[model samples]
Target: MSDVDSELMAGLARMLAAGQQRRAARAQTALETLRSYERRILREAAVMGYVLGYQSGNLDGRTGIGGPLDKNNRIPPDSEILRRVIEHCDSTDDLYPFLAAACDRRRRSITKARRWPGEAGAR
Candidate 1:
């Protein structure tokens, strides 16, 4: 092939590669966003479940229907975020706001714990 033809082909190939790379990066970002939402939903559900189960256990114990509930007081601290969400966003499946708040609460707690003084696990 002529030099000009070869260079043109190479330029086209480079453009195609750049476009493919851009598309792939965008797809990856979308996937990550979806996965982040998924993770938030699961975390909120689990934390809510923990709180509910603790409450249920307490009721059962009070009624003498079962043993004491959450004797170790394992009720999650993050439960408050879920409760607030329920109070404010009642009757909706939209947990985006709740997820943001709940994750932030957890992140703050984690950051605090990491800086805890006189603790073996402290940084």
Candidate 2:
């Protein structure tokens, strides 16, 4: 989640602690919605990463095609195209296993990144 999200959640927690029941409930709902959206985006990123044959631990791999190669830059074309195709694919049932593996890879990446400051923000 972003810094703004963290602030909002903290505010909500404070309001709940202060006994502002109705407002606290509303804020809690908003927090849940924000969390759901965050999860969806991370899932999307994982799908894109997997479709491009990106191994989680190998962030320095070459693409063989011409493009920017910066860790802080946007995802490459092949990944973006693959993600689009996956988005339009009708047979999601077949993609579940791949998505699950991608999610596992993302989780591991996140865990490792968290150990180093500022790496979490890049993911």
Candidate 3:
């Protein structure tokens, strides 16, 4: 090919490669954002579970029963399984699994509630 054509082709190749890199970077950023959102949601859900559990226990005539917590940074919950789940984690990596456990209970509670809308202990 002519020198001009060769250079043009090379320039196009560079542009294509750069575009691909940009797309990959954008995808990575999107994935990271989604992951962050999921983690935050899980942590928040777990915290809600903890608060609800505490309230429920109080209402049900149980007094002074809850797991330890990290006050500075908000984390997820307490209970039969939730008590240990609340006391389980300290860091982000550790917290996710604990949060998941709490969320699992939340999930079960949801399913049970849906199945038996007017009953207690539906599951």
Candidate 4:
């Protein structure tokens, strides 16, 4: 895995460990704190991919394989971004929690995309 992926995973493991020790209101605060790191990491990872690809001359005009990104590669999928999207999710109570969990799952998916083989052992 790349150094960026390792760093992000390390940050997430620490956040999760910290969350385990939190209680009551503190747990909510901790989760929000984690959410911020989650956003930062996702942004960094996406930027890393886009920058690497652009520098490698892989992206061309408006309609090639990956296509032209203009000023930005597609924005990374962020947990908070998903949470905002979930604000419009079906309001059926059970579905609300499921959507929230889906946001977390997306964050995890980004790491999995990195294919960090040692992440489980390291974390």
Candidate whose lDDT is highest: 1
Better of 2 and 4 by lDDT: 4
lDDT of 3 by residue, 58-79 (tens): 6776554342333443333222
How many residue pairs clash (N, CA or C atoms closer than 3 angstroms) in each of the candidate models, in the order given? Answer: 0, 0, 2, 0
| Model 2 pairs whose backbones collide | none
lDDT per model, in order?
0.50, 0.45, 0.47, 0.46
Off by over 4 Å in 4: 1-34, 58-101, 104-123
lDDT by residue for model 1 (1-123), tens: 999999999999999999666544433333343346654675587576766765687776663433353345444466344444433332232433333333223222335444424454654
Q: How big is the positional error of residue 1 in model 2, measured in Å on the Cα after superposition?
A: 56
Residue-level lDDT for 95 in candidate 4: 40
- Please list all clashing residue pairs in model 3, or write none if there are none: 77-86, 79-83
- Say which prediction, candidate 3 or candidate 4, comes out ahead on TM-score: 3
**Consecutive 10-residue window with the lowest summed lDDT within model 1:** 101-110
TM-score of candidate 4 on Cα atoms, chains taken together: 0.26
